[model samples]
Target: MSYISGARKVRVMARYDVIVVGAGIIGAAVSYYSAKKGLKVALVDKKYPASGASGACNGGLSYFGKSGKLLQDAYDSLILYRELAKELDYPIEICQDELFVQLATTEEEIAELEKNVEECKRFGLDAEMVSKSTLHSLIPGLSNKPIGGAIAQGGLHGFVNPFTVIYGYLDKVKKLEGTIIPNWEVVGILTSGRKVKGVVNKKEEALYAPVVVISSGFETAYLLQSLNLTLNIMPNRGVVLVTEKAPWKLKKKLMGANFGSTGQNVSLCIEQTLEGNLLIGSSQEIGVLIREPNIDLIARIANNALSFYPSLGKVNIIRAFTGVRPHREEGPFLGEIKEYEGLFVASGHGGMGITLAPWTGRTVALMIAS
Candidate 1:
C-alpha cells in the first residue's frame, strides 16, 4: 500500500505476518509480544495509542474482587505486569497492596469481607481480614466509620500508569521492527472464503496479512458484524474524577466492599496515583455510547470519596473523564475463531483491559506462533 506524504507518495509493505487492529493497551501489547517472537506485525488504530479506555482508566491492578476463572486470569496477568514494570524502560507505578473497606453501617458488608477473604485464601491468594483496630493502624486517617476491612496483599494487587504501559509496549514494538499506523480507521475486514485476508481502511486501502487480531474494545462488536460475525460486545460507560496533587499520602488503594455488587446502582473506587493525585471513581452505566462526563455521576463519586475520606472533602477536582468499556456476556474473547482461520479476537475485558493486557498479549502471541 502507498499513501501521499507531503510531495511524495510513499509505498509500504502491504502484507505482514499479523495485522493488529487498535493501538490501545491490548493491541499494543499484542504487537510488542508478537514482534518480540520475530513476527512481522502491523498495528493500526483510528486514533493514537491510548486514545481509548486505556488512557482514561484509573489503572488499578486489583485481583481480590474477582474470583473463579477471572481471578485466575488476573493473577496470571499480574505476574507479567510485575515483570514488565521492572523490565520495561518506562515506569508503570505498580503498587502491590489493595484495601477493601466495609462501612460501619453495613455489618453485612463486613461479614461479606470476611467470607471473601476466606474464599480468596482457598484460591491460593494471600488475603487477610483486617480488624477495625488493624485497619486504623494501616490507615491512620481513615474514616472510623468503617467497622473493618480486608487487605489483599502479597503481589495480588497493584496499579500501573495505563499511558506508560501503552507507550512502553508501542515503543518496544517499534524497536522490534513492527509497523504502527495511527489515525487509520479499519472500515472492513477483508476475507477470502473462510480464511481472513486483511482489513480495509477508511480510505478504502487494503492491508493484507495472514493473521488479523481485533482488540478494538467497544468497537469490536461493530467491526466483527461487518464480517458477518455476531459478537455481543456492549459498551458500558464509567466516569472517574481526578483531584489535584495532594501533600498527604494514602497507605493503600481503597475500594468499598459493596462496590459493583449486582443490582447496585453505584460503585466507588478511590486510589492515590503515583503522582500524588487521587482518582475517585467509577460508576457503571450500561449502554452509554457517548463519552461525555455525567455531572450526576461525578458528584456522586466526589461525595463517595468524601464519605470515605473526610479529608478529601475540600480537595479540588481538577478534571473528570469517562471511558467506555467493552462488556461481553461470556467474558473477553481471546484466541482464533473457527469460522475464520486467520482471525482472532482479544477484547471485552471492560475496565480490566490494562490490567490484563500483558497476559492477553502473551496468550495471543503464543496462539499466533503455534
Candidate 2:
C-alpha cells in the first residue's frame, strides 16, 4: 500500500489493483482481461479509446510473415478475436468473407509471396497462390497488374472494425466493474524507492494502485523519463484515403507486397470498409509524430490505387487521415519492468497494433495478476 507523495499529504482520488495508462486497443484489452481475472482495473487515457493509432489502423490480422514470438502472439490474437466477436457488447464485425490477398506486381514480390506461402504451410495456416489470369478472375476490379500473390485463409486473417474493437473490449471491461477514465492523461508515476505507488494525472490528481501498466504509445517515453528509464520507441506516421462508395466490387481485402517492409515504407493496401467506402493507403514516415496528412503521400496513394484499380480513377476521394504507430526495432515490448517491482509496459507495436493487441493485453494482464 502507498499514499500521496511529498510532505503535503494530498487527498488521493482513487485506488485500484491495476492502473492502465492508455485507452487504445492494447490498454482496453489489458483492462478487460484484468477485470476478468477479478482484479480491480482503472483504464486511463488522454482522450477516448482508440484515439491514436488503434482508431486509424485497418483491422487486418496478417500474422503470417512475422518471426518468433511476434508471429506466435499475433496468431494467437487472431484466434481470440473469434471468441471476442460473441462476447463484446459492441459489434467487432470480424469478416466472414473471402481470404486476405497480397498482390505482387513484380517477380521479386512473387518470390516473396511464395516464401510467405511456405511460412503459412509450416505453421498449419492455409494459403493459396493465384496466377495473374486467375487473380483477375478472382478479384474483378484490377487494372491488368499483379502477377499473383498470397491469399491467407482461415483464422481471423480477414478484417474487423478498429474502433469497434476498442469500444467492445472497454465496454466489457466496464461491465466487469472496471473504471474508464478519459481525458485523464497520466503525467507522472508516483513511486516509492524502486516500487511504483500509482500515477499522477495531468490535473495532478494522485490515483493509487499497486500495479501500473504503461502503454501510452509515444507518450510512454515521457513517463519513463520520470523514473530515469529509457526505451527504443519512435512514432511512425501513416496516411490513408477514404473514397466514395464504389460502383464495382472488391472481393477481398488486398495489400501490395511492396508495402509494410519496415519503418518508412508505403503500402498499396486497398480494402472496402464495412460502411461500403473504399479505403486505400498508405505512406509511412518515421522519426516524425506529425498526425497531419502529407500532400505528396496523399497524391502517391491515389496514383497507386488508380494503377491497381482503374475504376477508382473517377471515384471521388471523400477524406484522408493519419495515425502514428509506436515503432520499435525489436517488435512490441510486453512484460514487467524488473528494475521497478509492480510496473509493466506494453508499447512499440509498430504498425501491427491491431494485429497484436489481444495478445499484448491478455499476456500483460496475466503478468500483473500472476
Best by lDDT: 2
Per-residue lDDT of candidate 1, residues 209-305 (tens digit): 8899999988988998887786788888888899999788775778888775644445657888888899888788778878888687788888877
Per-residue accuracy of model 2 over 1-370 as CA lDDT, tens digit each: 3345843244589989999999988889888889999999999999988898888877677776675666678789888887887877577777745468888988999998888777777777777777888778777768878877778767567677878888888889888999999988887887787788888865567888989999998677778887788788888888889999877667577788877787436778888876678889887877778778878889988998788878788679999988888888788888888888888999989878888888788898888888
Off by more than 4 A, model 1: 1-13, 97-107
Number of clashing pairs, model 2?
A: 0
Superposed Cα deviation of residue 284, candidate 2 (Å): 0.7
After TM-score superposition, what is the CA distance of residue 11 in candidate 1 from its true location, in Å?
12
Error of 2 at 83 (Å): 1.7
lDDT of 2 at 149: 77
Q: In terms of TM-score, how similar is model 1 to the real structure? A: 0.91
Residue 91 in candidate 2 has what lDDT? 71
TM-score of each: 0.91, 0.94
lDDT of 2 at 90: 70
Error of 2 at 243 (Å): 0.7
Candidate 1 least-lDDT 10 residues: 4-13
